[model samples]
Each structure stands twice: as structure tokens, then as C-alpha cells.
Target: MNTVPVNFDFSVSSVEVARRLIGVTVLVNGVGGRIVETEAYDREDPASHSFAGPTSRNITMFGACGHAYVYRSYGIHWCLNFVCREEGHGAGVLIRALEPNTGIELMQKRRGMETLRLLCAGPGRLCQALGVTREHDGMRLNTAPFELLLPDQPVAEADIVAGARIGISKAVDIPWRFGLAGSRFLSRPFGRSHK
Candidate 1:
């Protein structure tokens, strides 16, 4: 039987929701991975796609919480975000990185690299590894082909680290980016194509 919670905490603010997601296992298709990094975005934040209100592109951000809001970045790679907060609240938490748990070969094939860390170490890379795209937008995260398996308990605050989100100019001081402390799966702060 599946041990993951069917309902994740979606009532909390984007920041809290991001913090709570660390350590949860995300399953897509036949592959699964532990979510190691995340970034929170709320309507109030200028960096959020919903900040200027929903458009045809961000419709999924206004639907249900705990749903995937996959979108392409720079027309080159797809990024994955989890819709959060109340229905219509317009909030999302980006799944910035993950630790591959299954189907490494497929992930490598999709990402075009064999390095374990690079397989799913960034928002784009993770989505590419899982074959997620705008087509998967609005898909329920607790169901098949897109599942989230919660941990027994939230990762301890001490084991978690907060930092400013990368590659964004506005709301740069919010410190909404969260990652498992010392985790190798976090999108590296330095180096090209890292953020």
C-alpha cells in the first residue's frame, strides 16, 4: 500500500509550505525522488508569475492546491511548481531539486548526462528528468503519474536552510528558498546553469 499522505498541508503560507515539502518523495511516471530543494512564491511577491494576476499561462496557479504547475523556462527547459495556499489564492512552490530514487537510467537519458547529482539537481533538470511539461499542468500531485509521498515528519528546522531565491531580482531578500542543509541535491548557488 502507498504510505504517503493523500492530502498535503496546503493551508499554510507559501514559505511554510515550501519548508514542509523538504524530504517528501515525489513520484512521476515510474520514477521517484526525494524533494531536496524548493522555493516559495506568493501573489504578493513580484517574482511570482501570479504577481500580476493570472494569464492564460498561469491558470493552473489559481486552481487547486497540491497540483502541478509545470511551465517552460526561457523556452528551453520545463520548470515544476506545486500550487499552494487556498483555492484562488495564487501561490506556488517550485520543486527546485530532487534526489533520484528510481529509474536513474531514464532520468540520465532524458537529462543527457550520467552524473547522479545532475540528473535532478535543478528545477529544469528535474522536470526534464521526469518528462514533465506544460501538458502536466494542473495535474493532481497526489495521484498517479504525479504523486507526493510525505515523510513521517517534517524535516527538523535545524536540518533546513533558508536563502534568497536565485536568478530573481525582485523580492530578492525574502529568503524563501529552502533546502535540506548540506544536501547535494540543492541547485548550486555558483557555477553556470546551476540556478
Candidate 2:
């Protein structure tokens, strides 16, 4: 219910900047949605998409800060990403999951489910629930309507845990993924470290 002041929009050029998005809150109001769970994926890391360098699919990541870079995976499953770092920097934060709040009916209708966990539980699911599509690519997060607003109280780095990214085979060696600790809203526990 509390709105926080807008700081310098995060520069999406650096992977380190993207990895720090763990505690940030993503808000979608037009559809009556508030998402809480997220996992940060830094650039420069071999596991990151930007690490392979920017392509037409990833150009938004190389642009200015505070924007969306929604993309589809395997010709299905739309994934939501938040641009990070300064303009021209090829870094962005991948929103891996979310905890739904508000508009249970709308979310359920969109997702075609009634279970609480099924609504906005994973990146693709979250995107589906909030009506995020490829059309939302490159939208500014700090502008209005749709934005990734950080809460007045951050979850803190110490409280976050790191582990290998899910559903990725390449660069699994890099431990750059970050998520909230002990949150059922999280996609899954990352081995024993997360427990």
C-alpha cells in the first residue's frame, strides 16, 4: 500500500546490476496485479543471455534503464525481463517468478486455474497471469501503469539466496541467480543451501 520514491532507474548494461533485483516489487495495475517473487540474473555471466552478446532478440537489454524486454521461449512461454544498467549496456534482470496479490478472479480467469500457487508462480505463468506479452517489450518500468516498483522495505541481500538457474543447460556453472529465502512463492528450493 506504500509507494516508494523513484531512484535512478537501474542501468541494465551490467550483469551485477541485474543480479541485485531480488527484493524489488513488480506492479501491474491495469489488470489488477501485484507480483512479489523474483530472481535476478546478472549480465556478463556466462549463464546470462546478454553474456553471449546482444542480438535482435536482446536489443532491449542493451538500451536505457527501467524498461521491459518480454520475450518468448521455445516459441511459447513468454518471459519477462527488466532492463538494467545505463543506456547501451547489455544487461537486464530476468523475472523468474512471482507471488500474486489482488485480483484473484482476474488472474484465475487468465490462467484458467483456481489454485493459489498456480497463479503467477513461474515466469511464464506470471507473464500469462498479468497479460505481459512480447508487445510489452521495452516499456519503461519507472513510467506509469506497468512498472517494477521496489518496495519501501527491501528484502536485503543477506536474506537472499543464490543457486543455479532453472531450465537452462548452458552456463549452469555460474551461480548468479538470486531469490528470496524460505518463500513458498519461489519456484523451488535450490539444493540444501536454500533449505
Candidate 3:
């Protein structure tokens, strides 16, 4: 069993949290699925919203750990992230993709499409499908409207892959992006060498 500690401790580094989240099932008001892809970011990373310090938009990231940091990408679709590390540490894991297994019909209705793979393949699409928006920012992940459950089946280490993050101009080569190996639900394919 892959047990490198799966307590969802947000006090750890963002990288560790991102890797551990791979097989975890997440539900937002009873609509979500197993997290398949994620990207880690900290206050020191230039690509992170917290790199320059806390702002009104990124203030949630600086708050307590294990909370939602919802934001809009390109002024359009909302993206969801899980804040990590200590309070005022400004670190989080971007929830990039999911293998949706719950509330499939509702997700299809909200996304306006019937394709299962495309429903939660990307951060923006995942948020839209789960009805996550700015309203969820700063909300605790352990409370109502959110449920993060440990995997029933332990995930194997060899099944996880790492690569560079996508849609960013800075810190492009950090290789902080993590995903479940061989999962077709990923937002984008990882390079062969990433494994």
C-alpha cells in the first residue's frame, strides 16, 4: 500500500501535499471526483500568485491551511486550489484535473457537454462542472459544500508522474506539476521523461 502519510496535513510543503492529493476523492457539495492532476506553488515561486506577497485576490492563500483558494483564470473560468503550509505562508496546490466519478449527470448539465473525459480535465472545466466560483474562496475544505476523502484503494508511487506546469510564463521548468500516470483524464499529457 502506498502510505507515505495521507492525513491531508496542510502544514507540509505544497509539493508534498500536491503529490499526496493524487488519489484523494474531492467533492464540492457532493459533486467531484478523484484528483488526477495538481501543481504546487509557494511564496517563493515566481509563477505563484503569492510570490509577490498577499493581495486581495490571493489573500485566501495566506490564510489557514486546508481551505479553498478559488480564482478566475483569464477573467473567465474559475480555478480551484487548496491552500497549504502554515497561516501566512502563502502556498497552495492547484487542482488541475480529476477523474470524475460522482454526480456525472449534474456535471454534464453544468458544463453543457456530455463528454466524460472533458468534463473535469482542466482546472477551469473542473470548476465549472463542480459549480465552484469566487464564492468558495477562503472556505475550509473540511466543512460543508466540500468533502476530501482518502482513497479507498491506496495509490502506487510508480503511478504518479511529475512535469512542468502549464499556462504560465514564469517558472516554466519547475517540474512541480504532478499527475496520475496513464490517466487519460489529465488536462494535458506529461512528457515521456516525466515518469
Best by lDDT: 3
Task: Assess the local accuracy of residue 158 in candidate 2 as a C-alpha lDDT between 0 and 100.
Answer: 67
Query: lDDT value for candidate 1?
Result: 0.84
Q: Write the per-residue lDDT of candidate 3 for residues 1-195, one digit (tens) a residue.
A: 222234668889999999989999888888999999999999999999999998999999999998999999999989999999999999999999999999999999999999999999999999999999999999888887888888878578899999999999999999999999989899999985365
The clash number for model 1 is 0
lDDT digits (tens) for residues 25-131 of candidate 1 = 88888785999989999999999999999899998998888788988888898999989889888999999999998899999898899999888988989998998
> What is the lDDT of every predicted structure here?
0.84, 0.68, 0.92
lDDT of 1 at 43: 92
Please give the range of 10 consecutive residues that has the lowest summed lDDT in model 2: 30-39
Candidate 1 segments whose C-alpha is farther than 4 A from its true place = 1-4, 189-195
Q: What stretches of model 3 exceed 4 Å from their correct place?
A: 1-6
* Candidate that beats the other on lDDT, 1 or 3, i.e. the better one: 3
Per-candidate clash tally = 0, 8, 0
Candidate 2 positional error at 90, Å: 0.9
How many pairs in model 3 have backbone atoms within 3 A of each other, for residues 3 or more apart or on separate chains, i.e. clashes? Answer: 0
